[model samples]
Target: METAVADRKDTLDVEDLAELCRALGHPARVRILEFLKKMDKCICGTIVDSLPLAQSTVSQHLKQLKSAGLVKGEIEGPRTCYCLDRERLDQFKQYVANL
Candidate 1:
């Protein structure tokens, strides 16, 4: 579900923040974010290699992050390179700070 926040450079609204929190609710998803932060960029196989979860499970977590706009993916040849959306994450932090 796209939101006005997705198109704007401003902060996320109440609903968007709630959705982002839910997307980050899972521990596995948190771990995936941490792993991605350390890498310059990563592919699905690399993420699966770093985590204990199965490839499919990791993919699900990635999907959640991507959908939430926390991460961005670009297809490169046979794999998709994933990276943290640092600006959006910083915006999330600011939103949480005000709360």
Candidate 2:
């Protein structure tokens, strides 16, 4: 017999979903994601300027998002450029939709 969509464990990685959810738990993170979505790539300072949060706080949020695989960052000279990991974001969306 076929299992229901919600009961199919193979449909999505629960742990990954949980991590992504946690990464997006904060409003700052969500706004950062939205900003990254609009721009092809941005530096840490640019993101900090866009939000009212301090540079260190924004960095922390970026770190959490990066750890969750939702964002990608590359070291460029003295700054780090960031962009959304579209593939991972899409996967997370799919996982949520599957639930």
Best prediction by lDDT: 2
lDDT per residue as tens, model 1, 1-99: 266656563443777778789888999888888888899588888999988998888888999999999999999999999999998888788778968
Work out the TM-score per prediction.
0.83, 0.88
The local distance difference test score of model 2 is: 0.93
Q: Candidate 2: lDDT of 93?
A: 92
Candidate 2 wrongly placed segments (more than 4 Å): 1-12
Per-residue lDDT tens digits for candidate 2, residues 1-99, read 357765576645877788899999999999999999999799999999999988999999999999999999999999999999999999999988988
lDDT of 2 at 1: 33
| Candidate 2 residue pairs in clash (backbone atoms < 3 Å) | none
Instruction: State the lDDT at 4 in candidate 2.
Output: 75
lDDT of 2 at 5: 62
